[model samples]
Target: MVLVTAPLIGFSGEIIWPIGQILLPVKIGDAEHSTSTWMNFVVVRSPSLYNEIIGRPGVRKIQAVPSTAHRMLKFPVLGGILTLRKQTIAIGSTLIEEGWRALCGLLRRNLDIFALKLEDMTGFSRHIAEHRLNVREGCSLVRQKKRSQAPKRNKAIQEEVEKLVDAGLMKEVHYHS
Candidate 1:
């Protein structure tokens, strides 16, 4: 990889010179359902809350749709749609609290507002808001070929899926041909 000085603007309106750039293969989702794409990552010397940030190009390559309201990311896979859910809530770093007690009391009082666990979820709805994917004229949906897995891996996958079904996070559905 060749070293290049790339200037990037920060969120705070500060200009930064990147240390280097490298092309890497980034894969998202699990083994059964996933997509891979080669991305050019710019190494920077700065402090950030996030470890790595995938810009719009990387997301477009994976064809992922992220929803802040739903707190999840969805994308098309071989068999069906793959969804990734956010487990933790984001707290503003600028938030001022009197002390730990005040912060704890505030969170305690609003415990019902956040879904901290599977048990905290009240219900599930397929339709949260109106959303549509615009397909270009004459463009066709590409069918992905299913990859075969080892017997042990398949059994482990099935067990993990059953756990999700039991937790009300996933359910088996029969699609009519």
Candidate 2:
């Protein structure tokens, strides 16, 4: 780390001075599927709210797509896509004291209602939610023309379906046309 001065503005209009900057090798995702790059981090002499904040530069360097709603970071790796789960959830900044506590308490109380992973969720059932396409009355059923997909795409789709099936979220079924 070298001595440098760069002012960083906080969320609440607070100016924070960095102690220095260091070029460190940062790795993202698991060992089986991952990406890495040397990043210059601005060292701050203050407590951190998050583990690490990767800005647009870092995200672009790794070619990652972060979805705040899904709470996941996705990037393309050698063979397939790699996804990293984020534990933190964003809430309204205006929430304070009782509101924050109440929200946390409510989540804790309803822990069973939340499924962090597909495996944690209950098996799929028609009772939970169901949908049916609107078909015209007295219309003959027409089968769409059969199409073939690329081998790579077929393999990927099979893998995803298998994963869902193994997790009990999906089931194999056959319908006679």
**Which run of 10 residues does model 1 get worst, by summed lDDT?**
125-134
Residue clash pairs of candidate 1: none
Candidate 2 segments whose C-alpha is farther than 4 A from its true place: 89-177
How much is 49 displaced in model 1, in angstroms?
2.4
Q: Give the per-residue lDDT of model 1 (tens digit) for 146-176.
A: 8888999899768867765777666666432
Residues 82-173, candidate 2: write the lDDT tens digits. 77654432234545576677777866875644465665544444332223344677777788897888999799768867876786555766
lDDT (C-alpha, whole model) for all candidates: 0.65, 0.67
| Backbone clashes counted, model 1 | 0
Which pairs clash inside model 2?
A: none
Q: Quote the positional error of residue 164 for candidate 2 in Å.
A: 29
**112: Cα error in model 2, Å:** 19
TM-score versus the correct structure, for each prediction: 0.47, 0.48
lDDT of 2: 0.67
